[model samples]
Target chain A: MSFSSTDTYIVSNALQLAVDAAVALEKPLLLKGEPGTGKTRLAQELARSMDTELLHWSIKSTTKAQQGLYEYDAVSRLRDSQLGSDKVHDIANYIKPGKLWQAFTAKQRPVLLIDEVDKADIEFPNDLLHELDQMAFHVYETGETVTAQQRPIVIITSNNEKALPDAFLRRCFFHFIEFPDEQTLRQIIEVHYPNIQQQLVTEALDLFVQIRELPRLKKKPSTSELLDWLKLLLLDPPKPGQLREWMSDEQRQSLYGALLKHEEDFPQLRYLRQG
Target chain B: MFIGLLQLLKRYGVAVSITELLDLLAAVNKGLAGYSIESFYYLARTILVKDEGLFDRFDQAFYAYLQALDEVDISERIPNEWLSDPLVRQLGQLDEEVLKQYESLEQLLEQFKQRLEEQQERHQGGSKWIGTGGTSPFGAYGYHPGGIRLGQASNRQFSASKVLDKRQFADLDRDAPLQQRGFQVALRKLRAFARSGAATELDLDATIKATGKQGGLLDLQWRPERHNATNVLILFDVGGSMDSYIEQVEQLFSAASDEFKNLQTFYFHNCVYEAVWPSAARRGEVAIPTGDLVQRFGSDYKLIFVGDATMGPYEILYPGGSVEHWNEEPGAEWLNRLTHHFSKAVWLNPQPQQRWRYYPSINIIQELMQERMFPLTLNGIEQAIEKL
Candidate 1:
């Protein structure tokens, strides 16, 4: 009923269609994109739009699926047993409900964001297949089963580190967040800084694209980086003519750190920088 | 329609299963795409393809399906003689009923194939090549900037504007030069992980066990983290025949540097003989001898030879056959000694696999390497890694 683009988040038609399909089919949406392409932000925006609670499961290399479902604090339990505490009698007291368990038992439908899912081991996605499929997990400690009251919207983000198992991927609606084109990127800039001059926006975007397209650039500036550069530009506004001069001659430029993240990329930037 | 699209996708080597088909059908039934070709393309792609690497294949298949779907209807509407009428295409300019005249579909296709090559040459030379809306017999082969020039869709207003006009996977296309990311991903699969470093990482399991036994006292244990101890030595073919593949070999070299902690690189021209130099940059320095190279790196190091493998058979089999230097021993003997020393040895030929049979040197090298020769492509590298 509402527009896909809100005050901040701007969704493309293709992405909106993908979202709709995933939502209608009641399946987990697996999002793959380059770093800083707003994979995690998509989950937050979805939660905001749906007015649902968000449960984030930020995975690391050593993070196990068991931790996402529930974790038993054995150290605390052993200490409690030594102290002869009454809390030791009930094993549930030591059981800490994890992100998945919290999402499952949420009062309203919630958004479960598995941020950087690929950072975990290759078999990590396979381990959660059954639980994600049924939206229910078995707690062995208390012999209790936690089931979802309302099916939560599951969104998984991957940095494309490792190929996911086919079995896990088969159950998901996949969407690759393509780097935005000039028009969409312009819209994004407008959303961030509506009062900024149109000429400055055009020139900056041109320079940004030029820097990105420099041959074999080690690291390209991302959307957030562009916003940061723009913010700095707004603070110390460069004259239209000086901006052009400084942009071409790298030594004269003051705010290149915000755009060029890698030192290795500067050699090419200097060679390819346009007047 | 979905079955047709699926068949096309499968033909393009994108693995789309029955589950994906059902998912697509469900999305369609729910009216998520709202019956628009553009929306349906996105919906179908999202439902079917999981990996971004396969997105190129998916886009190709989908585009083919859309074009083929419209082609049938458009062809029926146009006069039969309009296309089947054979005329000689003089590069971009068409000559009317002159020179080579052919009417049968086979002969027409043969002519088109010949023109296709000429068109490629013209396109590469300058930007003034004939494209869509051209009077040439093969107007479809004319440049379209967006994609490979298909039939004149602009002539007649088509019912569906091709939703995906751009080749999304042009960078990932197997025929194109390999990118650094592709090389890194392939090299990642070749890794043989071994824990061989300082035991600085805390062993949590052992710590917890010891702490339990120590009775309320915290105990910490340290163990080594899994380190990539796999050593790699790449012998690159440079100068003469390998000058064209400099960019590709450099990408592979960079990727190898990022992936393997223990890596050694050497540059040889055409074939490895008595000596190979470390890098082109330090070529003024003394070249490392083949025997010294064998002694320097361990047997566990994976030996990869990157070349076109299209040199004269004499260069490999006979002594003093190297183009620049007269080798004391034949290149074959050195290759054999190196292969014997390093159990994991492979020859990566940048030349297409189909052309390998034409090059007798490649066959000889393959036989020597025990058929561990692979084409330098995404799939080829992965298969080579598996063999490693």
Candidate 2:
């Protein structure tokens, strides 16, 4: 769903302070929030407003520092070297820049989105800090230091899976994204799914709020999850045996899995369904 | 001329892709305080673009030169302000001096090694320990000093004294029940005097005020006054990893409940977030509403957060990291707010005091709570009481 920056809820003054810090510092802002709190979408919107290319790098646990900077095509380079001995020592011929380096050296500034940075190993953040600090990096292979001609807006996101080292955290401007309150949640629902009836919206919101308050769940239903479930309900409004019949085996299982993390919570859901 | 050559080479190094040359120029530009962009550009175009083929070769050479310069600059700067920064200064006085000494000593060791090896070869199988004859040079035969003893080895072996593992302090049974003991001692002292008996000490101020109301005639009806005990809100972290210490911590909680008249108990996973509920039975189900909690408990309530502050530090940085449900904010923010609302709050960590320094999460929590974290021991509880 398309959400304007104005439409976003200003829950805590801390979040606004973080945004202001990012703008003042002119650095890529790192938003650390719970999963489904729209940390990623915030960067996307910011990039859109700035008219910068959003080069997203979805970091995984296995993502390496070198992989983020550049990947060498060793086999291709070797073949080319064999074919032409004259170009064997050419530095530019072998250089393959990664998103971080490309964004820094881009003719027009781009937004380098390092998503889920906490998932990546500790070394990844440490390696990025050098570039983040000076807005420049030296390519050792070619003996060239690529500085930002037009600095790309850098945004790093973390789910707080682990504590980032102080050295790494000190380099970037940080913000924490909080979950939307009931009013904000209602606004979001109205903005995105306007077609849904008011009664359905209220019922869904009440159920969603109750579900969030349920102590057993690991992840509270994020706004995105609420919207998805709302869509599912609207497409096929519950009839007699509708929840059982319309909910495909896969769909039902997935929904159950999302809503409930523990076995004990299953019995609690019976009451929710009845209500 | 040198600057012009450097500028010329940097401008056209792209053809040969002398990246090193460009990097060197960039580094130099960064290092030079007042160097203009025009001068840097001029230097890059002049010396770097000698020929298209030479671009890559020049880049490598340029980088090597800049690196050597950087090393020299770093070495020159190391002994001054860099050494004074608290983080670097913490390496200990011996370490700082020894590191410099080792660099010089390494060369001397290499030089001495050659001479030692030659002497060893010439001596071959010669006896260094033996004197002229079969007997040793010292006084008697077998007059060996600093050697293994020959007599029956002493069965009285030296053993390290058993240090009580600090972790045992968290074990409720091992330590004396101070709360219970204190309560018993106080009760015993109070019980010594009969309830209706004349108080040993006269309340002169009360007697004077009574005289003001009535006549100055001595009206003696002695009654002992009982002081109300202070209320305590002990929020014990239970379940998950805390399951290990559940029995011991529960004993402490139970003892506290029995000892204090106004003792209230609650359970949390790691920290006290928005609200702590009363029903320990349905801890996972019901939470005491925030409004209700504030109304019921005044600023007088002494808050003791009992937990092993061992978790991913992110829980404090991000909201929604509770073991059961996503907390709205990092536990620290809630902790900060709670501390502001309540004057007397202390955190009792089960983890050893030494290890708390390493865990960033614990350190953060400790900092937020004004370093009022104490080990969960009898002494710790007493100290917490004193602080409150």
- Which runs in model 1 stand beyond 4 Å of their true positions? A1-3, A83-86, A249-251, A270-275, B64-160, B163-166, B195-222, B354-358
DockQ of each: 0.39, 0.01
Mind giving the per-residue lDDT tens digits that candidate 1 earns over B1-388? Answer: 4898888888888888898898888878877878677778788889998887777677667877876643222222222222332222223223323312434434544555556555542122222332333333343323222222333322221122342222345455655557777787678877666776789876768978888789857666789877677889899888777877777788888899998988988888888888888877635768888889889888988999999988899999999998887788899999999999999889898888888899899999999889999988877898898878
Worst 10 residues of 2 chain B by lDDT: B155-164
Query: What CA RMSD would you report for each candidate?
Result: 7.9, 37.1
- The TM-score between candidate 2 and the true structure equals 0.41
For candidate 2, write residues A1-275 as lDDT tens digits: 12134444323333443443344344566776567787787767666766668889899866878776776554455556546656657757767888888887777777788999877655678877777778777777777787878767777888654446656654555555556666667777776776767776776676677777665343466877877787778766765433444444555655655455556566555454444
Docking class of 1: acceptable
Deviation from native of the Cα of residue A223 in model 1, angstroms: 2.5
True contacts kept of 1: 0.63
Q: Residue by residue across B1-388, what tens digits does model 2's lDDT show?
A: 2443344334424332334344334435444213543233223423233222233333333433433222111112111221121110123454334434323322433432433343322111112321111111111112212111111111111110111111111222213333333323222221122233346544556755664566544433334544335677777776666777654566566556655667777776666667676665645567875445557789888777888877787767678876667677677777777787778888887776678889898888888879898876555665665677
Model 2 alpha-carbon drift over 4 Å, by segment: A1-17, A83-87, A239-258, A261-275, B1-388
**How much does candidate 1 score in TM-score?**
0.82
